[model samples]
Target: MASNKFKIILWSVGILMLIFLGFFLYQLTQSESVNSIMILLMLLLGLILGGVIAFLASKKLVSEPAVITESSHTIAESMRKVFKVVSAEGHFNEIYNYEETTKLFNFIPSKKKALVIVQAKVLVGYDFEKFKWEVDEQNRKVKLLNFPAPEILSTETDYKYYNIEEQFFNLFSKDDLAKVQQNGKQQVIEAAKKSHLPEVAAEQMRTLLTELLAGKNFLLENPAKISETKNLIDYRNMNNSR
Candidate 1:
């Protein structure tokens, strides 16, 4: 609406300026004196002032929000109701893998259409870690993965271990890092109990969750254990293995 008003104001200003120019031209042709120049200057000043006023008026109109009706409210409610109807029911589980030292939660909805992995970590001293959500759709199924950070492997070490401490330390201060670890641990327990995930998956999830939430540093800093869980396998590999 504001955009339309601006256009109208622009058009009005243009028309008024054109009208003033035409009058000024007539004066110049009819009279040849200093008074004619002054008249033309006055016309220019009036056009400038008018343009400014019109621009301000248009801005004022555009900045205001539009009013909504009861009908719009009803439409929004109807859409929400439809969404609830179509949404499927799924199961959730928390898994901890000893090898990976990570915790993860798996959610399986009634639709059997998507696999979602939610990873939550703590950032520095902040109460919450950045959450990342990734969704992969395959064979009419959607796989969603959400984690604080992307999985990192140590190239120097033969055994690939997820260095939770190193990762968190890199992002946060020492004090903040400690808090993040504590939160990560709590989150793992919550995800496990809440999701009621499978035992195998829950174990791996717990490992990672504990490392992230433990409030302490990892045990083996150099020769870190590698991640070899089936869940860690690429999506395509998961399908092929199945």
Candidate 2:
């Protein structure tokens, strides 16, 4: 906003300067005084030099540092939208086999046995609702305050049970199979986390921000500079050590 105001003032001054120069040139052209044409030419040359100086002065003023504050709320909201914009997924499968046998009575008994197989996948990356950032407009830079670490966002599983032999005393219920499916889904999520799928998503976000801000003349400040801080911080807290 200040930049816009500065430009308006500069251009206003420039236009007035040009108008005065034009008026003087007109009057000189009508003059019958000695060396009138020569004087007019010199005035035109002086006007060119003055105009150049004025343009440079305006540029210098515009470039001067001004405090531009961007709130955490604004950045966080925008980043949240972009966070859900694209998501990364990790695929995994685990072969889980379980056998359980149940016998009834001491000497005469029928046995119940079953075989199970499970496959699962995990979704990893930003959820968008949890986003945080800080901006320093004066420096034309932004800092990622807090971001979701690599984690399993969601999981899907498929399972099959076969080769079952059950007696009246022993049975496998739907509840039992449901428990196995849930376990399989959890295992897949843990595996995905260990594989650093979330880290891959984080890198993607970094690239996204870099590209997003490039045209805006904004830079993403390095995260390593404040590696110690676990949350978002004010721009003043940043140090030169980075």
Candidate 3:
């Protein structure tokens, strides 16, 4: 590549010299010749000097570093044969009343309670690691057997406390905060189990695979056994609790 670029630059210099010579001769012929020989020598010297400057400028322009807008740094990476695809997501917002009691003596009891507000999101999808399939490219046949089951992929929960009440003997402890948060998160998970998020994600996955295989005209041999993921996670029915 460097050799080719050098040859191109040499050809450019030769062409420039020819153009300057032709122009100088044309102008000399049109005007009266007082010192034509001296003018010719001077023109030759100027052409060489100008061509050298142009060549150096072109080289400088080509050698300048490329401009970068984003210098992104990679922190972590991993290789995976199959990745879990989240096809559907749902949000569940509910208020949970966390109540607890502690026994100070045989008959006396200390009470503590808080109105816990639960806000959470549930993501449902299929893990491709469990997927089973068979493909025949020769006969244009695709058999999709035991498909990956759509399950609760992940969940995010946030809690807020309101109207917290407790006696001096049964004030909030370190375990109380963790216990309330766990209880609120569990409620959201249980609610997601009854929703239709899993079913919707399964349907979306089916459509995606069908469209992908349509281009190659691969007939789905086993379409009956594909939709097996039970419906779970419904956003509409995620109602607030007291």
Which ten residues in a row are the worst by lDDT in model 2?
Answer: 233-242
Candidate 1 C-alpha error for residue 73, in Å: 28
lDDT of 3 by residue, 67-102 (tens): 989777887567657587888899999789988887
- Please give, for residues 81-107, the per-residue lDDT of candidate 2 as tens digits: 333433456667665554556555665
Colliding residue pairs in candidate 3: 195-232, 195-233, 195-234, 196-233, 197-233
Question: Between candidates 1 and 2, which one is better according to TM-score?
Answer: 2
Query: How well does candidate 3 match the true structure, expressed as C-alpha RMSD?
Result: 22.3
Q: Candidate 1 — worst ten consecutive residues by lDDT sum?
A: 81-90
lDDT of 1 by residue, 40-139 (tens): 8887888789879877876776656779766533343333221101011122222322211222234422110111222432111100133332323232
Clashes counted in candidate 1 amount to 40
**Highest lDDT, which number?**
3
